[model samples]
Each structure stands twice: as C-alpha cells, then as structure tokens.
Target: MLKIAMFTLAAAVTASVLAPTAHAAHSRIQFLAPSGNIGCQLGATPDGSGFAWCKADEHGWVTPQSDACPRANVPGAIGEPGGENLQLAEGQAPCFGFVMSQLFFDGQYAPPTLGYGEKRSVGSITCSVERAGVTCSDSKSGKYFQVSREAYKLG
Candidate 1:
C-alpha cells in the first residue's frame, strides 16, 4: 500500500508540473493585426443593398469556408488559386456595398519571436481551400508576420 501511494503521488506531481509547460509550448503563433470588426457578404450593388449575410467570425472555426476562387496552398506565402489558365484576381476595395467583410481574427497576436506590439499589414486577401476547410483569402484581415509559429507546423 505504501509503494502504491508513493507512485501515485509522484505521478500526480509530475503531471501537474508538466501540464502548463506543454500547453504553453503548443500555444505559439498568434494572430496580431486587424484584430477586430470582420464580416462577410456577397458581391452586391451599392447602398448596402442586396447584401447577404455569411459567417461573421472564423477564429477557432474548424469548418472550411470557401473563397471567391476554388483552392489554394499555405506556408507558401503568396497563393494563386485556379489553374495556370485563369489568373487569380482580387475584388475591388471594400466599399459601401461591394465586397462584403468576412471572417475576422481579432486578438493580441504575439508569437515567441517578435513578442508583442508588432504590426503586420495584411496586403492582399486570397481565397483558398485549406485542410481546415475553405480559408478566407488573405485580405486586410490576414496581413501578418512570422513571429514565432514558424518553428511549428500546424498541419
């Protein structure tokens, strides 16, 4: 009985000590910019007319959301959807009733590298179907940098 109790106590202590460290290690790579006010709508006319509502937030969303284009690849930086035949295209700038604002990643993103207070401008938005289902195109929402998650591959 004494040996069993000792083993149990040891195991519990070991687990408690290592649990937080393990979680922190896996918690690298954070989204850091355009961290708020994200929405999605179809290409419609002016005056917010004929606008359709899609999913608002995509953070931690496991389901895939398709983009204007069909498919894309990640970690490659710039991704062009469709085949070599059709060139990837970007819609017009966000207007009163044109491109609809879609998914958002609003939060203080700080990977282990840059730490915090680092800002990356999401230049162009690309619509790609990733393993996580359909991912939003790299729009102003995706402008980010490789601060820390570079070390780990989330795939």
Candidate 2:
C-alpha cells in the first residue's frame, strides 16, 4: 500500500511539472511584423498546406480578442482555416472589413494587394483563385463565397 501511494504521488508530480510546458507549446503565437496592424498565427493544414489566421488591431497590438477571420468548417493540421498570402509594400498597413482584409508584404514600396483566396485549408471547404474571382466552398455546409480583386481597390 505504501509503495502504491508513493508511485501515485510521483506520477502526479510528473504530470504537474509537464502540464504547463505542454500548454505553453500549444499556445505559442507566431509574431508578424510588429509595425503592422495585423498578426497571424501560422501552422500547417491537414493536407500539408500552410495555414494561418490573422487578427487586426488599429494600434498594431494583437490580442486573443482581436477580430479574426471566419472559422472554416474544416481545419488544417494546426486546426486553423486561413494562411498568409497578401504581400504588402513598405509603409503599408492592413485594411480590414467585414470578415475579410487586405495583407501586405513585410518590406517593399508598392501598393498593398488583396489576399483573395490566398490562404485556405483543404477539407470540406476548399478555396482557389480563378480568372473570375476567388472562390470557396464548404461541401458539408453547402456554403460558398467569392471575392473579386477587379471589383475592389487594394488598401
């Protein structure tokens, strides 16, 4: 009985020591440009594609409560729906709107470009860029949305 109690205590101590480390690893945040208003947490999709989700804060500070993109019905390897794609020029910033935003490159001196269908996870919901526009669909949900760069101005 004494041996069993000591083993149980040791196991509990081991778990307590490792619990915070595991949680911290999972909550690691990928920092984007500190000067930019948008911050993204990046990872891989189930199909081995890059994935990321971003939030925008006007003050260039990112927090958990910042506005993020709509959650995808299907998630990537890291369990997110979006990826990074919009490249911005130097001195440029993100332009966010209802459930969408424009992305910029880290350094350059050109106009920012819209990241339409640039980042996506492969699953029930799939997205692609075509001549007509950026198209996405969730087969399970039977939902679809599109964006046209020609119809909108970049930030």
| Candidate number of the best lDDT | 2
> Per-residue lDDT of 63-108 in model 1, one digit per residue for the tens?
2222433332221113433211111113332111122222343335
Stretches of candidate 1 exceeding 4 Å from the true structure = 29-155
* Sequence-dependent TM-score of model 1: 0.24
Candidate 2 per-residue C-alpha lDDT over 54-144 given as tens digits, one digit per residue, 9 for 90 to 100: 4333432222232243334213222332333221111222222222433444556322333533534433434444444444444454444
- Per-candidate TM-scores read 0.24, 0.28
lDDT over C-alpha atoms for residue 99 of model 2 = 24
TM-score for candidate 2, residues paired by index = 0.28
Clashing pairs in 2: 45-77, 46-77, 52-82, 87-104, 87-105, 88-104, 88-105, 90-108
